[model samples]
Target chain A: MEGNLNALTVVFTEFYYWITVVVMFLIHVGFCMYEVGVSRRRNHMHTLMKNTMVIPLVTVTFYLFGWWIYFGFQGGPGITGGIGDAPFAEPWSALMATHLSGPSPDLGVSGDEAALWSRLNGVFWAAFLLFSWTTASIVSGAVIERIRSGAFWMLAVVIGSFAWIIDAAWGWSSQGWMVKLLGYHDAYASGVVHGIAGGFALGVLIVLGPRLGKFRADGTPRDIPPHNRWLVTIGLFLIYTGFWGFYAACNIPIISPEGIAGQITGETWTATNIYLAPTTLSAITFNFIMSLSGGMMAAYVVSKGDAFWTYSGGLAGIISASAGNDLYHPIQALIIAAVVVVVIYKLHYWVERRFKIDDAVGAVAVHGYAGSLGVIIAGFMLWGQPSSPYEGFATINPLGNFLGAVIMFGLLGFLPGYICARILNAFGILRIPRKVELEGLDFEGDETYNASVAEVIAAEKAMV
Target chain B: MSTNGLTSWAVDLKDVGAIYPFQGTETVLVIILLVFWIGWHVLQTRAETREFEHDLAADKSGDEQRKAIDRY
Candidate 1:
């Protein structure tokens, strides 16, 4: 609407985010497939539905309050002041609907703000919404089979719409207190998305307990093999593809120095992390592939070429190195990923045995432990580096990021998750009864289907 | 003149901002949508609980449950 340069930038940025939202949809699809694949044949339909419902449920609730939480609570509310203004993200804003980017004085949006947000807001909100679905779906995998659909959906809304979004506000946002005070530097949400979701899943798993027969009378854990290996492999592959979109969504694709209005003073236009610090697509691409390769190779050797663990290790690799991927040398990313996978793989089994907790899909280790480690690793790797381009922000340090990781994985993630799951459990809704668990979640549906088939066959025989 | 406040397309496009119909009633629309969303969870939760309770009442025999496990 203004200069040609401005128009192009706005359109391109808007389209860029829109594309990422589309691609990130694959993450949810992958989750459904992966959960169903891991579940028994008897529980297949129920498992798939459990993950699939996360999409719609999280979407509406996210539209309601999640997006607003991201902008409004960046101050810690308690840290800087109180809940701040975020006119563009408010659910009732005119900009929240279809708009052409002109003046909206009656609606309290200025022409300048409207023009920018009009093109960007929907796509940005959608991209974050997809991340919300991913967060809830991550928990869905670890709690399949025994978790009541009703209870899981309620928990999904909590994490997808409330808990994870709050962590995003506190750590992932540019003006978050974790960044300004603690020098947190999770450029790609190793801690914000993956870490918190993982911890939340762990907390829930502790309360919900394992699937029936997940343990033996002797207290030894059993390895429940996936019902379908092909689906599991394909699901993991799709997640890898969607993760590219997640990484892209984490960046401000292109911005000029003045756009950032921070310490960065240059004529060069560049991509930046969520914190408005400069990075490049090239840097992340190199690290993403390298770390993934490192994770797979290490996991294959460590788990003795177990396909499930190998694929998960590759994901853990990307997540473990994601915090510093923007600045990491590819080899550094690879080495970090390789080492972290071994530790997490062992920790997964250790936690399983020691705590008698059964994680159906190892989500707690792959996402939670790997993600927290990544955030802490970034502080050391990028020590003394500016956490944000903004003046007066704290420099990146180990202590700051360690505390940030704790806030992400423990304070925000585990506490809310444990409390919510406990509430649901106390109400006798968290886990399905032992009778239902043994009979299969789809028992009634399967029985009805069998009866229908028999009746149709009898009718067909009479016609013949 | 229109629900979207557009009488014509004859004017400069730059003057147009919100093009959605019933723009001023966004707050009301949001309120209605919020109620619908929360209502959905309530209904869904009740339905699911009912299904589970019905399944529990139907009460498959021990042998049938064993057979179901074997299907896995």
Candidate 2:
């Protein structure tokens, strides 16, 4: 009977993650379409391809090392302890490949670990890989027309596989040093993924320089609107759909107190966040809709029904309240989302005018600034609450989350991006040549497409 | 003679684990996959650079640019 129950639990958990991976694929689709809508017709193909390729580029590299880093570096490699053992996540571990969950001492994983992790490994890896792709794609939309695809792909790999995973290990993991020491908590990666990626895009943009003709001699900014307004709104809607899956993937579907090994005193089975703290899908569901409503309402009033900002406000709202959605009252999530969205919108324009940083789609404000603020707000809202069920862990606090936001957006996000962009610029491989930018990134491809269309039309005319 | 080492289904399910062929070759498979992944990026970058150079050479006339803008 015990064997049957264990098998049932494992299978159910496996299926749960598989479903989440399928839903998360829409986030990539939405990102690709949104970028294409934002870019000009002349640069459409390049914009689409740049975002599309992040899927494969990040996936392969994440498989190579990113998964291992999450479990391996939880101790900060020195903060809490030495590099931890994560045999199941090793690229060459048999558990990472096809397995029936049977004993195989030849594999790096022990028999016990294999029994638990083998079925869950692939789906778990894929779910995190989708998040990595999201982080990389956030940077893609900000540097559309002028950046080289090769340089961008390289940057994507660094963020998707290296930088974001390191932050996750530090803050998102149950045993992460940040959670253990400072009581850092971001249930849905408001800072770990969005904040870091947003900051990284800002760093790259500063060094890559704004799009040509983006600023005038007087230093006032011009509004470069999306070519397909409808497409942009539709893409935002699709992103909202995928974000639902993202929230689900952040949980352990079902586990008992015995499994958690923490301070909770009950035999009850429950879902938990990545930090092994109690939460429920029902609580987050209520929070997601209310927060989204608050953001859209605030943005409609602020932007005066501007389609792009209004839709983006919905996303920024969700991101802003994401950190504490796991625990906040629905009304708290709504107010937080409303306040953060308004601030991010105002800050977006202020930064653009103040610094002449031409962010094509407000990625920095929506993701970086909003995400960082969300982490800080979660700290204050949940202050003195237990960060984890584990004994002796720090309780959630304002100071810890604020420092966490800085580390995510500055240390891990902006620093690497700035250094990388500077190096790529020095090597003269960062941006497209000026003539190429003016003529458009897809000049030759467009010409070919044009010639083919004319020939097809002429042939059809003859048939008439 | 079965490829998966599974000739019968009468055995207890608890004894089953890895049923795939080449079970012990995970290390070699990973090395091969790693090389392919890196090699793809190298080849792809070269192709992309050449394509960009071609686009720069072919677009001296701004006719295509005007048509694209007008279409928009």
Candidate 3:
């Protein structure tokens, strides 16, 4: 508020994130369209609504506690330290709303708190809120056609507002214990977002079981093609578009060494990843395009030019390289992305055939399997590198990253999801009844649509 | 008479802490919003149950089922 350059930088950073939030909205639009495209004609509306409702439910819940958890649990509340303070994020905090940087004792904050909260709080909270939506939406696709919206909404709140945010606190936060002690690094959340969501979907699917008739008498799986191929491809394309915003949002757009107060020197201002480690958006852009190309090409050959796998491969490709994309060479990113997609593609079928676990959209393979691989692969690729610009944190290594992946995909992602889903199943609210599913989850709504169509047709014939 | 402390805009803008009316009522507003949010879920869940029940009965004729399958 005092000086020109300082004020401009703060305002610029706020506006930068605001734009990213708008762009990231497309990711949800894509998820909604993707689920609708994958569902059969009968189940279309139900599938779309089931995913759509996650928005408001998760937003409200995330506002209630999710933003607080990101700052509060950074310490593991014991491991690295105790619960950290985040007064600005509190629901009742005046800083949560419009305010100038000038002091406000009514809100019970010192001038320092006012300065940070006035500019960054709303946009930062909004940016993270979009990520919460993405995490829950990832689970939405795998459980389509049969999951009760009531049950799914609860699951969305758990993943979007609670479980995933805790993991972000643990791994993605700058002062997080995982980063402090273990050197757990996931720059773009390859494991944190995609891995956890994919695993959560897998856990729910295990208890929810397959859509009826997914497996035959011999226990072989059947292919359920998407009702509309074009929509699925377009959905994936929109996700890729929004992913640009996600990447930019993950960075502190521009910060000086003095601002970060870390090991970085020379007063250089640069874009830093979630851990406040220096990285250029340019470096990640090269890796993003390279990995995506590698995934599409590899998916084409492996799935033999299947449109669905090809598009999903593009997504899996970027996700597989995302962990190291901030630091990786373009060629290195490409190879890693291509290799992970091939392995995940093969594993998807192997799991389906061996376990008879029906993942409707291969979300488990594309997200969970590929994302974990990306995290572990980054360990080898970025070995001996600083996980943060901070002092005394462990250097990036295989063991820490491997454990981080396991914690993300299995421990945090799968375990709670499985337990909660099992409870919901025991109460028999998780999945629709067999008869209702077969007749179609959207049967009544579609019935009304068809009735209206028939009435209109009869009236038109009489006029003619 | 205003819920907000300020009765006029003649005061310096910088002195203003919260512009909205009833600034001190934040906790009350939050409580109300929370009640509305949770109440909405309860009501929606009930409507969902009723809608599912109706759909469950609608397909008893089997004719609609055949038509849907044929359309597929």
Candidate 4:
């Protein structure tokens, strides 16, 4: 607390991240509402609880090791020289707890690193923790109804605290191997968060199989309409609102030239993306609204004004433009969003019918397909552009981004999901038993309810 | 030349303005987007008409409609 300006900036940055974490919490709330709304009445309670529990399960596990993965693996062990150190992020590290802005003898963190992290660590950890919950929640929606709570929670920890964080370290970090060698860029985590989650959901879908009567005997898919269209629409709206905070959280808030230590030379301070490249809040705001409008309009036409698709399309639109939202023109964002929505909608059905995959919500298409497409499209859209302000990094290219998309969706996302699901299935814990699923996961609880109601009604009659 | 006219970000932040790709093609892009916007409505109206016609022809006995209403 030496200089007034320095103290103000540090406190303001902390408050800024704290507010974003609160707003981003609505993303999980929206996911719960949307999932339960899409599920049948018999499955509502189970669906809600299943998504809700991802919060505590992921939060604890993320605190234990997930935060460590982000800082420790940014080097790829070979790309940025060797295995990086992150003692401050460790669970038992003294720096992980509350401390005044001074170097501690209890932790191995250097004086310089400790001074910077002392104020920023908790809020930064919280912001990333919110992202962890979002990634896991994305998978929770696609596999509702038949999945066991135990199995789903295990999967949540894997994706929430492990898979997505590893991908973030690889692609989203400024000094990531993908950034250094491949020029991989996902400014708003289209591929890092949405793409990977979507891919993991698809991988599980392949092994878990469809919910009992998802397809007819002749190989045609059946439409299982949402129980509450209003809830689903409102949920999507809330998600869109929460996404504003998500966008802001992805930036550094404010940084001077000396802070960045990159090639951006000036006394002028500005907001930078994850890679320390310059951007502005005003630019992203324009693109966000424009892309969302483009998505909604295209979805209204394609789905013939279906409320669910219209809302989901707005999400898809933001996701499609998110890769380049940091730099895209509003109209460019609009057209890209429109084109991507059509592709994703078509792919959703094509994959559904071809594979008999029953995604309770259109998560695979909306998040997975849209996200992957966004990354690849950005490569072409932003080709020959610098992925980082740092020297010696490869320039952004179509081939690099295409490969990066595969690595995000298939390598990190799908592979781990399939392996974990297969192991769980072999142990007979991946899905509920056939009888329980057919009767509804809430069958026992519902029976207890009926019995209690009968006894209460009889007692009231006797009193009368 | 890069899409945004800067292949590298190794420059002063104060000098940068618009960083989006293809800075001068805004008019052409808008025209194309307008066509897409208009075309969607035409296709949507046709699809809605066909769906309603199918619904009208199939279960006019009100059994399915009643079930749908009750379920909601």
Task: Name the runs in model 3 displaced over 4 angstroms.
Answer: A457-464, B1-72
In model 3, pairs of residues that clash are none
Chain A TM-scores of all predicted models: 0.98, 0.98, 0.98, 0.97
**TM-score to true structure, per model:** 0.86, 0.86, 0.85, 0.95
User: Tens-digit lDDT track for model 2 on A77-131?
Assistant: 9999899899889998888899876765576666656777888999999999999
Give the candidate number with the greatest lDDT.
4
- What is the C-alpha lDDT profile of model 3 across A187-217, one tens digit per residue? 9999999999998999999998898888999
- In the range A257-335, model 1's lDDT, one tens digit per residue, is 7777776554677788898877788888988998898788778767766789999999999999999887776666777
The numbered model that scores best in TM-score is 4
Per-residue lDDT of B18 in model 1: 43
Q: For model 3, what is the error of residue A156's alpha carbon versus the real structure, in angstroms, after optimal superposition?
A: 0.7
Q: What docking class should model 2 receive?
A: incorrect
Q: What's the interface RMS deviation of candidate 2?
A: 22.5
Chain B TM-score for all candidates, comma-separated: 0.87, 0.77, 0.85, 0.78
Residue A19 CA error for candidate 3 (Å)? 1.3
TM-score of the candidate numbered 2?
Answer: 0.86
Q: Which prediction has more favorable lDDT, 2 or 4?
A: 4
True contacts kept of 4: 0.86
Off by over 4 Å in 1: B1-72
Please list the C-alpha lDDT of all candidates, in the order they appear: 0.86, 0.87, 0.86, 0.90
Interface C-alpha root-mean-square deviation of candidate 3: 24.2
